[model samples]
Target: MISYSKIRTIAAEKKLMDIVIEKDYVLDWILWGISENDYLKYNLVFKGGTALHKMYFSDWRFSEDLDFTCIKPINVDKLREALILICKDVNNKSGMKIELKSIEASGDTKEDWSYEIKVEYLGPRQQSGGNLPTIILHITYYEPILYEPVKRTILKSYEDIPGDFFILTYPLEEIFAEKLRTVLYQRCYPKDVYDLWRLTKEVGD
Candidate 1:
């Protein structure tokens, strides 16, 4: 398995360690709150951007968001409220103006299945500090093929080394599928296209 220290060193070399460390602290805070409040069982699936893909042997461009998956259905409103309060509390403690933005449920999506939340800093572009220029948090739950709720399951994989790592990521095949769908249905980002190629090669190997 790739050593966590190695990952941290790589991030530090890339000037991303500060952001990484800050995000980890914030994530732990959220986890603690969720556990204390009996929110739901969840595991931190993803952390540092490149570290995520690195765990899967895929080449991914840098990203500034923290992605998580809930192992059970969460009360959307309650979760949002709690996150907002936590953000405020953290801001008060740190003197950093962090903003929590809730994306309304829409577009033929079923409730109690999956949703997204974003937490960002409010300031001038250059004024934003951390490894994350903009902090985007993604929270998704399990949904079956028929849009039915299902028990959230952890996705596990072995790192390139000889150890196991729980990867909070879609399967490489599914990722490719989504990439294709995005190219067909939305304006494609060049980096995304590059990522698809990189992932494809890695999976093939």
Candidate 2:
């Protein structure tokens, strides 16, 4: 685990210390450790806001959850067990407490099988409240690939947070396409609009 001081020093050097919070730095490390393990063990591909944050260097929005898409069919029960083990391993390594609350699997075909995992995090970084913060990971297995996935190397300057690593994710154009689709066909989120605008400025359609 990277020390908080190290994260701060790096952030200060990058001129992002004022924007990225400490808790988020910790969460980003935890997310990286989990993602690294998942890619090694299950070959899961990262996606959504988290992917965008990595793909777009100037995009500084912090993601609250992790999202991924499975490349092929796998046993749901086994996948759940692997995920629980991953949470346990990350907690042990990072000194963060994480527990898997539940894993709900739905959808008939492999192309649409969705695995929604509810995870509880009991860490000092979070505010003391009635309930602890839950890390939600939405996984869809065998989703039709809209574009080819590529390995993205997240440089430290991009986020000024810990846990920079290489992750396989859909291309920027695909992410842009999905963002537009969400605005048009799905629930509208202000962040989506902002992301769409940012993508337009960064990469043209």
Candidate 3:
């Protein structure tokens, strides 16, 4: 278990409030741990803005959710159960109030089924200074991963979060393509524009 004092120290060093640092730490830990869970093992490829922050780049923007693409079919009910258990384990291990709020599935056809899990972390309310923080994990299946040579990276322990796990990520070019598509098709997010600019500056057009 990570001590509150330790978390506080890290937060202070990063110039981030304790609640922000603590909630992020627990959510990151849970994501890493979920990748290694035994009951629910599959080829879950991480992606989206969080993937950029966690793997593809050095940008420090905070991401409140995890996005993944499953390389194979998944049992939604079983996955939900596993997540509930994982949340309990995270609560016990990290001394954070982690709860599995809900799991929602969507998609038009069998070729693309997406499951989004909403997790709530209730910290010391007084210390947090507001409502609980929520983390979302979105997993989509059957839509094949486009890019080959997926970058293999390791997620190392940070602050109070402990775990070293390998993460499979789409290449920079593919991530760039995804951001472009999002900008065109979906509600424009400022972060996507920012990411595109960064990609242009670093990786070039």
Candidate 4:
């Protein structure tokens, strides 16, 4: 496991909250692991706020949840096994220990299935109730992709784990469209408005 001091130092260098960097590190490896996992590689289409930051805007605010739209129906047992394996792989590669605390599955009567996973990681700030950092994973199977997901390159400045990673995700325009869709659904989400503004600046007009 990487020393908490190293995590703290990188956070200081990046001028991000230590908790943010810590979560980002955990997220980076999880993404990498997802790309490596054969089932998840095809099943999960990266989406939502985290995908926006990692795949599109570098200046976007740090996102706390890893969200994906499942293109194919997957049994919960298989998903649970896949994520457990991914965490083990991430631990080996990044020296960051991530434990899968819980995986819960639910769906509306129409079979719009979804899963929520809670994972805990070692952290210095101890923000979580148990003095550990946690990251939430939300996987929804019903969101139709408005555009064909593309394989995009992902990067992080951390020298510890170097290399370009890739993920299958919605294009910038689709993310913007979805953000706009959400804005209409809710009256007071400032983040969605902020994201729309930034996305407009990136994609133009």
TM-score of each: 0.49, 0.76, 0.81, 0.89
The residue-by-residue lDDT of candidate 1 on 1-205, one tens digit each, is 2344654565576576554534443443333333333343333333223333443443345444555555555666777777777666655544445677555442344434555666665321224345433455666554222222222222222122222323344455545555666577875788667766776676574
The runs of at least 3 residues in candidate 2 whose Cα sits more than 4 Å from the true structure, single-residue gaps closed, are: 1-23, 38-42, 126-129, 155-164
Candidate 2 minimal-lDDT segment of 10 residues = 155-164
Per-prediction CA RMSD (Å): 8.3, 4.1, 2.9, 2.3
lDDT of 3 by residue, 1-205 (tens): 5677876887788788887766667656676667567655356777777777777553446677888877767788878788888887777766767888888989888787899888887654324556567888888885455686374554443645554555767777777777878799876889889887787776686
Q: In candidate 3, list every pair of residues with a backbone clash.
A: none
lDDT of 2 at 12: 78
Ranking by lDDT: 4, 3, 2, 1
The window of 10 residues in a row where model 1 has the poorest summed lDDT is 153-162
Better model by TM-score: candidate 1 vs candidate 4 = 4
* Top TM-score prediction, candidate number: 4
Q: Where does candidate 4 have its weakest 10-residue lDDT segment?
A: 122-131
Give one digit per residue, the lDDT tens place, for model 4 in 1-205: 4567877998788798777887887787788888899988977888877888888766678788998888888888998899899989888887667889999888874358788999888643445455577799998887778899999877564566546777899888788888888898755388788888888888786
lDDT (CA) for every model shown? Answer: 0.47, 0.67, 0.72, 0.81
Q: Which stretches of candidate 4 lie over 4 Å from their true place?
A: 1-3, 123-129
| lDDT of model 2 at position 164 | 49
Return the lDDT, model 2, position 43: 63
**What TM-score would candidate 1 get against the native?**
0.49
